[model samples]
Target: MDKHNYKSYRIEAENICVDYHGKVALYDANLRLKAGQICGLVGMNGAGKTTFFNALTGFVNISKGKIRINGESLRIAQKYQAIAYVPQSEGIDSQFPVSVWDVVMMGRYGSMNILRSPRESDIQAVKDAIDRVDLMELSSTPIGNLSGGQRKRTFLARAIAQRASILLLDEPFAGVDIRTEKLISELFIQFKNEGKTILLSTHDMIHVREFCDLVLLINKTVVAYGETSEVFTPENITSTFGGMSPDVLLGPES
Candidate 1:
């Protein structure tokens, strides 16, 4: 793990590019996020949102550029400790036998030394995370049997337990109801208030505008990035999505 004593940008990626085989997925992407900000990662389908997250999380090797957390250069091996990722719900295996508590505990497992049991602090963290997500009653439930919202909350609990300063969430509200969406949004707010830097991918512009302090608009590359009010305009949306329906982009008011 490379280290740099740089100053306080919580998350930064500079001139990032990723290649899948010989095909380019992202190009020259640069993003910097401060602590305590909820930034929305929004783009059309197949627009490399997931690819960018993968690159940031070290799941995919970046062909060029650097990612840093709290001023330290991020290495693939250090990604687990530096970031916690909540992937899309469909990615969760319905047939997996793990209980919710077990899944949440796995988050803390990375921070524990190898061959050593979890410390009291780790156990407490897991419990607090579970309670924070309002899943204490369902903690012992098999993850497979939980509802879509419950599953989403379970994974969120896992991320909270990881206690990483930076969280990368991919389509966290995809399958849940509006009520559940509101609940998750509140959790993000709480995390932001606590000074966690969060980057979440979502298709809902309404939610993006409502909760995100900053927004990154991308389509295989960065189209725009800045305060939500500035970057999420119809013009930028059109540019990013290749003229998506005005009705869809602007809603009824436009």
Candidate 2:
């Protein structure tokens, strides 16, 4: 596809396919996401949620197809730090012994000098991100020691500090409490209003129905995608999850 075709979209994936050692993960996945939109990437387990996110982050190789971010190659955008990725918190090493401040500060490293030192702006950015997530009081505490919710906020702050044009979040709200969920949702909405693009993968039907503007359902491939109000129905949900009840996706809708 031509680069000009990506002008109207914040991110675009055209026929993207990824495989690990010949085992297909994602096949011919196509999506175009615009700014100020929160897209929910939904599917059952091992159905390519994380694989799709990895494709966006350029962390995995694409056997075929193209991905453009900010109208540039994914690697170029990544090199300039135009994208931020917050992987599943459960996959993180909570015992890494880094403080909340330390974790957030790393986001600024991309803008630092050869020594990777922090300047006033970097410090201020980290501080602002931490404060925005309401982690100001625990800024000095070790991330490994925080509750599950706090840890999620800590990584989210890191992503915020980058001030990227797009954010790829993997199950960020999983295992979080109401307070944390509220804070995260608020931030997501705030960013969306600011014309930032956010795509998160999750099984949280509540979040999907309540917050997402767009929904992309994938069962190892693109099944359905459109406005959340339109494509997020039970029929599409069951089809995407291979006949599984939508309730089973997140334990019977309250």
Best candidate (score: TM-score)? 2
Model 1 Cα lDDT, one tens digit per residue, 1-254: 23443456888899999999999999999999888988999998889999998988888999999887788767743655778899798776866999999999989888788964789998899999999888899999999899888898888899999988889999988888777788888888888888999999998888888889999999999999999988788888888988777577768976
Q: Estimate each model's TM-score.
A: 0.93, 0.95
Worst 10 residues of 1 by lDDT: 1-10
Model 2: per-residue Cα lDDT at residue 106: 89
**Model 1 segments beyond 4 Å from truth?**
1-5, 76-80
CA lDDT of each prediction against the hidden true structure: 0.87, 0.90
Per-residue C-alpha lDDT of model 2 across residues 167-222, encoded as one tens digit per residue:
99999888898899989989988898888999999887888888888999999999
Candidate 2's C-alpha runs over 4 A off are 1-5, 247-254
What is the model-wide C-alpha lDDT for candidate 1? 0.87
Best by lDDT: 2
Q: Which residue pairs collide in model 1, if any?
A: none
